[model samples]
Every structure is written in C-alpha cells, then in structure tokens.
Target: MELRNDPQSHYALNACIDKYYGSKGLPCLPYGGVQIRTSVIDGQIHEDVYEKVYFVARKYFIKYSIPIDTKNCFAMLSFAIGPNYVPMTWLVTEENESKFRVDNTTEAVVHNLAMLDEYLAGRLI
Candidate 1:
C-alpha cells in the first residue's frame, strides 16, 4: 500500500525488491519537497517484495535493541531537525494501516503533508 506522508524519506539500501512496484521510472528523487513516494505491499500474495524497507527498519530496531512487531506493516523513523533538537518521527506505511491492527490509538488519522508542514514549521513538535 501507499505510505501516509513523506515517502522518499525512506530509501531501501540497495536491496533486491520491487516485483510489487516495478520501477517507479523516476530518474531520481525530486528536489526540496516532502520526499513522498509510493510502493505497494499486498498480502494476497503472502510474500514480501518490500524487504528493503522492512529490513532497513529491522536494522534500526536491532541497533537500538527496540522491540518491533515485524508482522506490523509500518516503520516509524525518528529524526532530528538539528543540534539541540528533539526528535520527530514519521511513520512509513508498508501496507494500509487502516486495514491492519494498529497501536497507540487503534487507527490511522488522515493528514495532509502540506498542512502538517505548516503546522510543524519552527514549532518543531
């Protein structure tokens, strides 16, 4: 399924995949935007084609020794704006969260990237 917001914030490190999303055909990532891109994950096939995304996240989990439900179809990436800044996280969806069981409130909240940009500007929450 499609990710919720900023999609290109993720780049699967040279992993063999995308039988599910066959070459986005973009020469490269676009400039200075939210980095939103799309990939597909379908359980109907009961196989994974997004292992790059999944495994990269797994790497972080292992490094931090954090517990993650690999069965869950999302990865939460935390980042910082600059030095002395608090972390902010963006949740990348490997599948539709509205379809899967989700934590922290049981459902996905629809949000627009542009609007979120306006909201988070400098406030940095």
Candidate 2:
C-alpha cells in the first residue's frame, strides 16, 4: 500500500481504538485501502462492504457525536486517499459485523484488525 504523507492522523485514530478496545488495529492494503474480514453471523451478510462500514461509522458518530462521514473511509483509516477524494471513513463487511458488533467504533475497528491479522496468520479457518 502506498504510504500516506501524514500518518499521524491515522495513527492517532488507531491509538484511540487501542486505548478503548485493546489493540486489534486496522490494516493498510497494497492500494492504501482498509478492509475487515468477517464471516456469516446469524445467517446474514450486509453485502456492501463499504456501505456496512459507513453504517457502523454512522452509528458511532451518532453515539459519540463526532463529525465524520462514511466517504472518508480510506483516508481516515488507511491514510490513503482515493483519486476522487472524499471524507474519511471506515469500511466494514456484514460478515464482520456479525462477528463483532460496532457498539464502540474504536473497538470495532480493533476487532476488525485482529480478525484480519488472524486470517493473515492462518489462525482463522
């Protein structure tokens, strides 16, 4: 993944999640995007990965009263801005949400990262 010019913001955000939830930080993909691995939960998958993340983020925003948009998913989480350029948001999949509830945005992110890490490490079946 292409490194961001300023990683501090993303780092800070991850730090926030770690502080609240415990480390399971997000991952930076080759194209500078973020993704979380999830499995079937209650026999339902949200379908749209980006949308699901946005929805969860919206819930977080409403709960925390933070001003953020689902549009900035990549920038805020991965520090990688897309060509179109939009607000910062995080992307999550329905399968993932099934495994972990997004009651806490930071914790959700951390859980996502931990899941991804496990998948990469071949710890997840």
Candidate 3:
C-alpha cells in the first residue's frame, strides 16, 4: 500500500521520532521519499531469512533488558536523520503501543530504516 504523507501524518511522525529518539534529531524525512527498502518483515520471505531479523532484534532485547516477550513482538525499521544518527531496527509489541530500538549497524539496515516510515505508518509487518 502507498504511504501517507499528509500534514497530520507528518506531524505525528515527527512527534514519534522525537519521543523515541529524544533530542537526537527532529524533522527527519525518509531518505527516498515513500518507499520501503527491505522486505524482511514487510513482505513474504524464506523462514531462515525472516529469522535473521529476529535474531538481531533479540540480541538487542537481551543487551538492553527489554522486557517484552519475543513471541509478542515484531520487528520494524527506525527513522534516522544523518550519518551520526544511523537508523536502527525496532521491536514493536503486537498492540503497536510500545517499541524499543534494536542495535544494528549495516548499510542494508540503514536503507530499510530510512524508508520504513513511508510504509504502514512507520511499521512493516
């Protein structure tokens, strides 16, 4: 589906970024304007490949002491502004009410994170 970029969505998107990223940056836009760069969780994939994303996310859950159960959450990409602020993968609860950034460093992750906001209101799963 096409992503929404109306005034209301932009405002809400900015607010969400501020809340999650804090003072790091605000008013950041997706790198390529309304496109998802990855299909790991956003589309169909092989079981092994799909698990790779969770494997990475789970590592962060343990390192960061995130309390959410593994089965109850899904992974999504994060919004990043610049070089110093690399994009991250996020573990989001099924309810979509809570999210925690996962530690990931790779060009593919960066592209996915940058374009994720353009899909499913910042979600892809």
Compared with the true structure, the alpha-carbon lDDT of candidate 3 equals: 0.31
The runs of at least 3 residues in candidate 2 whose Cα sits more than 4 Å from the true structure, single-residue gaps closed, are: 1-12, 17-97, 100-104
Top candidate on TM-score is 2
How many backbone clashes can be found in candidate 2?
A: 5
Model 3 poorest 10 in a row by lDDT: 58-67
User: What tens digits encode model 1's per-residue C-alpha lDDT throughout 1-125?
Assistant: 33222123122211112221134331222122222223345634232112111222112210000112235434322223333212123332334223322221111111222222333454323
Error of 1 at 6 (Å): 18
Give lDDT tens digits, candidate 2, residues 16-113: 54454332232321222334333355897532222112212111211111112222222222211343322222333445435433332445455544
Q: What is the lDDT of candidate 2?
A: 0.33
TM-score of every candidate? 0.21, 0.28, 0.22
Model with the higher TM-score, candidate 2 or 3: 2
Flag regions of model 1 displaced more than 4 Å. 2-68, 71-74, 83-86, 89-115, 122-125
Query: In order, how many clashes per candidate?
Result: 3, 5, 0
Candidate order (lDDT): 2, 3, 1
